[model samples]
Target chain A: AQSVTQPDIHITVSEGASLELRCNYSYGATPYLFWYVQSPGQGLQLLLKYFSGDTLVQGIKGFEAEFKRSQSSFNLRKPSVHWSDAAEYFCALGYQKVTFGIGTKLQVIP
Target chain B: DTAVSQTPKYLVTQMGNDKSIKCEQNLGHDTMYWYKQDSKKFLKIMFSYNNKELIINETVPNRFSPKSPDKAHLNLHINSLELGDSAVYFCASSPPGAGGTEAFFGQGTRLTVV
Candidate 1:
């Protein structure tokens, strides 16, 4: 089935450390990819998206994602992590109806 | 001003009761959707309305129905709600397309069935 997969269910990083969240898609062709973040008691906020363009896409909150066609992956990354970055992250894709992954919970430590 | 908004930020009701959650998007987008976020924080697409037309309906139960009076408003009504239905329901809107574009989301409505 065509879907998005986030390998890591939970990740913990120290403040000021780098962060990477892995995402892979199993689609017949490259569909639009997106990364969204949800803070506690909040709605899902779009961090970044990938369409038909350059592989690397920059998003809000000092985040970026690289879409690798060969690997079918669009992993989100940040140069340095912050405590406020601790939240639930979701990777999604679709052409008409968007689908989301289970989500990855990030815990940032000071 | 909020781009997307859902009413009744918190709802607590008994099982077997019926309820409705209203959603509106002032962004003037043509596509609106209803998504259910389970206790585990897993998001699932329930329904999609484009220009007030039902475009996508997942394998959701008949008890859950979505109504779109126009392109700007989409409401979800649940009949005989069950305890298992307790979760955070979100309403989102996007530009005329699919998941390819970023969606504007409203603060979810947390529903509790006791």
Candidate 2:
């Protein structure tokens, strides 16, 4: 049984401000982690994924995440958020189970 | 070409009617999946087919039947649709081998039951 937890339901940040979204997971086997972004009425787009190797991974739209094995955390970060960056973000864990977090709704203020 | 596509981008029908949503992947992938996104925007996997073999099937009602004519197409048929069934359904495709392989998603079909 695999599960993902995203503590924040909604997060608001100003344009050009840094942002970090927290995600935690519970999985027995080696976890396959992913971060996805969903815009209004659009399909989810992959931001980044962590399979193995370097814990720090970079993704599209200036997003990055670090996989912490001890803490079971894979947090997504962006140095500076753009207005268009506001959307729903989901964190997923495992390959077989593939449980997704409740999702964090990001709001970027101009 | 679209990697994954679903027909009837919008479906509106009355309760108790039967409707079907078709999905196809031109990506030549070996795996296809059906997911539902409810009004709360929570995405849940309903079924997964790998190479036309049913690999995963959630606790969906028998009214929801999925048929994979081949590896490239997986269609979902629903019977006795109810208002609670209104949601956006997405179809995704991916190749077999590893799990982390990115699953390409279709534009999604929004089903509304009146």
Candidate 3:
């Protein structure tokens, strides 16, 4: 069965600091990977996705993710974190049926 | 306009009652889905429809049923709702094809069983 794992349950970073959220997947083949962000009382918004192109993919809100086939990882990163960046981040894997990670709550501190 | 929307942003009902949640998407996508977010904040896929046809149905209980009148609308009807059924339900949509496309999500409906 395909599964997504987000090792970090929660992460806190000061404003303007760099950020990285780890994600690993278990699948037989290179599956479609995605990073989504969910704000409090709001629905999820796609940050980035890796299908079959370059390893590094850019997304909205200055978010970027790198897909590492060797490690079965698709990690999200941002150079500078902002107060508005505080939210729940989820890593998902799928093409027909998707599986979401437990999610990581990001807290941006000033 | 909202790309994806679910009616009854919040719902409170007693156990054994039957309720339905309506969802609609104006993005003209060919695929729609229902996802449940439990109290633990774990989001899981319940069902997916493509072009109004059932495509993916997870291990959800038979009490829960999804209806898609068209490609733009998908509704969930729960019968004999139980306390364990209380959770936030999200409606989402995507373009045709495999999961290569990013899905647009609704604000979600918070269901409470009392």
Candidate 4:
């Protein structure tokens, strides 16, 4: 079975601070990975995805994720997070139907 | 323009009643999908359609049937809805060939099966 795990249920960070979210998955070989962000009362927006080569994949809204083959992990990183960046982030793995994690809720404090 | 959209942002209904949720995408994508987000906020795939053809059907109950009149529309009809069916349903679309491209998602329909 293919599943994605987001270690943190929620995380709080001050505005203009660095942020990193951990995500691990169980798959056979290089599976397609994706990161999605969802705001309150809104639809999901794509953050980034990793298909093949180039472990470092950049996405919109100053978001980026790196695919680690050995660790079976695809963690999202942001040098500095803004208040608008506070939302639920989901890490997924698959092609046919995405298997999303429980999601990590991020809160930005002033 | 909206790429993907679903009807009735919120649905409140009684159990044992049958209902249907309509979904349409204007992105000109060949593949469409239905996902159920539980109370825990875990989104899971329920069914998928490509070019109006049923391709991927997850472990969903037979009561939950997806009807695709065309490639752009996929409606989910539930027969005798149960309380456990109360959750957020989202519609998404992809280009084709087994989800190689990014899928565009709709705003989601919050179905409350009482």
Candidate 5:
């Protein structure tokens, strides 16, 4: 079955430090991958997505993700973490019916 | 204006009560979906509608029914709600065509079943 996995359940990073969230997926074909962020009491917001062309796709809020077909990974990265970046991140895979990962909670330390 | 909006941002109800959550999207997208976020924060797709037609339905129980009146509206109604039903529900919409596109999400409705 196709699934997405975010190995880390919770991560803490100091402000101004770089951040990377890992995501791995299992699919038969080259699948559509996405990263989304959800803040407390707020709906999810799309961070970035990978479709066909470039392996590295940039998204809103200075977020970017690279889709690696070899490892079936689409990991999100940010150069510098902000205090406001504290939120839950989810990795999803699919075109129409998507499967979401368990999600990783990020806590930014001041 | 909100691209995708769900009514009743917060809902607290007793078990066995029937309740409905309404969703509307002004983005003119043809596909809409309902996703459930459990207490553990695991998000799961429940149902999807494309142009008022049901396209994807997960293993959700029969007690949960979804109705789409138009392309911009999708509603979820739960019957005989259980304590386990307490979770945050989100409504989202995407443009027509492939599913890989980014979806607009509503603020979400936090349902607490007591």
Candidate 6:
């Protein structure tokens, strides 16, 4: 079965520190991958996506993800973490009906 | 203007009661979907409609039925709701494509079954 996994359930980072969230996917073919962020009591927002070309894709809010075919991973990264970046991040895969991961909660400290 | 919108931002109802959640998208997308987010914050796709046609239906209970009156609107009706049904429901829409178009989400409706 095709599935997306975010190994880290919860991560804490200090403000202004670099952040990286790991994501691994299992699919038969080259699948469409995405990253979504959900703040507390709010709807989800698309962060970035990968489809065909250019393994590295840049998205809104200074977020970027690289699709590594060999590793079967599409990990999200940010140069410097912001206090407002603390939220729930979900890695998803699909075209019509997307399947989301269990999500990783990020806690930013001062 | 909101691209995708869902009515009843918060719903608190008693178990065994039937309720409906309505959704509409103005982005002129052909595909729309409904997803359920559990208390643990896990999201699962429930149903999907493409141009007013039922396309994808997950292994959800029969008590849950989705109606798409038109291409722009899709409504979900739950019969005899149970306590386990309490969770946040989100409505989303995306354009037709083979390259995986991005989805626009609504400000989910939080349903609490008491």
What's the TM for model 6? 0.99
Q: Estimate every model's Cα lDDT from 0 to 1.
A: 0.94, 0.91, 0.94, 0.92, 0.95, 0.94
Residue-level lDDT of model 4, residues B1-114, one tens digit each, is: 889999989999999999999999998988999999998889999999999999999999999999999999999998999999999999999887643577789999999987
DockQ of every candidate: 0.76, 0.56, 0.78, 0.71, 0.81, 0.90
Q: Which sections of candidate 2 miss by over 4 Å?
A: none
Model 3 chain B poorest ten-residue lDDT run: B95-104
Residue-wise C-alpha lDDT for candidate 6, range A20-80, written one tens digit per residue:
9999998988799999999999999999999989999999999999999999999999999
TM agreement with the true structure for every prediction:
0.97, 0.97, 0.98, 0.97, 0.98, 0.99
TM-score of chain A of each: 0.97, 0.97, 0.98, 0.98, 0.98, 0.98
Candidate 6 chain B, run of 10 with poorest lDDT: B96-105
Q: What would the DockQ be for model 4?
A: 0.71
Between candidates 3 and 4, the DockQ winner: 3
Best by TM-score: 6
Give candidate 5 misplaced runs (Cα > 4 Å). none
Chain B TM-scores, listed for every candidate in order, come to: 0.97, 0.97, 0.97, 0.96, 0.97, 0.98
| lDDT by residue for model 5 (B59-78), tens | 99999999999999999999
Which scores higher on DockQ, 3 or 5? 5
Model 5: DockQ score:
0.81
- Could you tell me which residue pairs clash in candidate 6? none
Summarize candidate 3's per-residue lDDT along B33-58 as a digit string, tens digits. Answer: 99999998999999999999999999
Candidates 1 and 4 compared by lDDT, better number: 1
- Clashes in predicted model 2: 0
Query: Candidate 3 chain A: worst 10 consecutive residues by lDDT?
Result: A91-100
What digit string (tens of lDDT, one per residue) describes model 2 on residues B1-114?
888989999999999999999999998999899999998778888999999999999999999999999999999999999999999999988777655777778989999999
Mark the regions of model 6 whose C-alpha exceeds 4 Å error after superposition: none
Candidate 1 positional error at B61, Å: 1.0
